[model samples]
Target: MTPTQIGLVGLVALFVLLALRMPVGLTMMGVGLVGFAALSGWGPALAILGREPFVIASNYELIVIPLFVLMGNFATVSGMSRDLYGAAYAWFGHWRGGLASATITACAGFAALSGSSVAAAVTMGRVALPEMRRYQYDPRLATGCIAAGGTLGILIPPSTGFVLYAILTEESIGRLFLAGVVPGLLLTALFIVAIYLQTRLYPELGPAGAPTPWRDRLRVTGQASSMIGIVVLTIGGIYAGLFTPTEAAGIGAFLAFCLAVARGRLAWSGISSLMLRSIRTTGFVFLILIGAHIFNPFMARTHIPSDLAELLVGLDLPRLAVLGIVLAAYMILGTFLEGFAMLVLTLPIVHPLILALDFDPVWFGVVMVIVLEMGLISPPVGVNVFVVKGIAEDVPMRQIFAGILPFWLAMAVGLLLLIAFPGIALFLPNTMIR
Candidate 1:
């Protein structure tokens, strides 16, 4: 059979395995390795299978993943997540749906540190859920907000999603991280607005709490300042060109470790256990990267990505129209596909079409990350929704999804705003210091 036919078979097999719930990295590696052997013979394919893991492992820039993840784990062990949540709640917990809004605020803050949506959801949910419950916040709204808020992890700085996107496209990770800032803030604000409007429409959903005294609020904020300071120094340093992203990640990790030690929340004896978990997560990310690298070349040989781009560009649709089609396709794929798998599988095809349409890569990267965020809360495969359910198991799954609807709509609005004003994403990146 021709290479195209083999590629087509591989695609079909990949989806079938995914349907059977095979892990994304192994599935991609298997299909790509076998498909390439079909086209280029077993010797070269076997060499790649043996060689590519070392290549991916040795990538210096990729150290950012493990370092950033370790930073998050340290922050968690330090009880910094609770401090951030407490500060946000001190400020916002009195407003109607204020508890939910505070969850978003806290999640955004933690997302800046953790860069993992699952970590944000789990960490915030553990602290905020019982409070929201005690205040009698609607289960749907309480759980929904956590699930939706956690997605900020991927759209904010130090995001693993941005790192993966940058690696796949060879774009600047710093630029992509900077690009996400304004939009991430915008989306966070929109989520707050959604909470305010929702509770306004149905006051019972989130009753107001007794307001905290100004002195207490100030005290809580002071307590949380350390977390705020660390994020600013790390992400801000990267933005100012004071250091590379890798260096920022390393600094953040050390600061987080020191904070945990100072707080007596993490024991020296537990260091090995913490390192093992971080290494495991880092290894998983590397496996995905390796799979994408192997699969990308095989897809290139099949010419599917080029053919699709040529066909789409050949149609001469308005660039916005083309972009709309691409995003719409993302929404559909996000319904069932896991976000990481969906990303590596499709970027080889979509990234070129995006460039061919003349969209700014940084801008598109930000836009794409938002789409991925939407997928995180989308039905069936909304991973963050599942995270919320695990935390609030007493809350029904449908209610969690119900709560996500408003935040999801808010996300749509944020997406539209970014598209209408590309500068929202491009401004900071464009202004980066030399």
Candidate 2:
């Protein structure tokens, strides 16, 4: 078969495996190895399978993944997520719909530590849901806030999404992290506004809480100081050129471990659990990366990216129009595909197109992450929504989906703002010291 036919058949097989509930990493690996062997030779395919995994796994840069995952696991165990929620609640709980707003605020703070959306949602849901319920907030609004807020994990600094994007596209990790800052904050603010408007129009959705005194608010914020400090030092260190991203991850993980021990939350058993969890998650990420690497060569041989780019450029559409179409495709895929799966599947094709258009890679990474965030809340495969539902089992699934609609629209608005003013994603990256 011709190279195009081989690539096409491999993709079809990959999709079939995905539909059969096969792990994405294995599916991609299987299809890629077969396609490569068909196009090149089994010997070359075997050579890649032997060397690629080690090359991808041993790269010092990828150490950031497990270390950051460890940091997040430690933070979860130490109850920093609860502290964040309490502080946000202290600040926002008194307003109408304040609890929901507070949930978003807490999610943003926690996102700085935890790079995984499901982790952010599950942790915040535990801390915020009970409080929202106690305050008589509408279940839909409460749950919606958690689902939407959790997506900040991908857009905030220390984000795994950005890490993966940086690795895949050969962009600077520091630049991508910096790029996400303003956009992450923008999305968080948009989510807060959505909550306020939702409550304003229907005050019954989120009842106000008893106001906390200033002293009490200060004390709650103080309780979260360790977590806040770690975030500042870790991301700040990278921005200031004091640490590489990998070094920052190590420092962050070490400090998180220290914080957990200091808080008396780190028993030997708990440490073991954190290690195991981080290792497992790291293995999963590494597998996905390996699969993408294997598939990338097969794709390169097929000339699909060039063909697609040529086709796109030949259309003579405005650059902005082309970008809109790409983003729209992501939004649709986000509704059905897992975020990482979508990234591994599309980045080889999309990233080249992005460069062909002369768009900034860092800016595109931020935009891609934001679109992925939207997918985390989109229906059918809305991972964050399902996470919230697991925590709020008494709430109907449909209600959780309904509740996320406003926040979803908020994400849409955030996307448009970033598009119109690319500065939102570029300002920090552009200011980078190097």
Instruction: Supply the global lDDT for candidate 2.
Output: 0.91
Which segments of candidate 1 are over 4 A away from where they belong? none
The models' CA-based lDDT, in order, is 0.92, 0.91
Candidate 1 C-alpha lDDT tens digits along 302-403: 988888999999998899999999999999999899888888999999988988988998899899889998999999989999988998888888888999
Per-residue CA lDDT of model 2 for 352-398, tens digit only, reads 89998999889999999999999999989899999998899999999
TM-score per candidate: 0.99, 0.99
Among these predictions, the greatest lDDT belongs to: 1
Per-residue error (Å), model 1, residue 226: 0.6
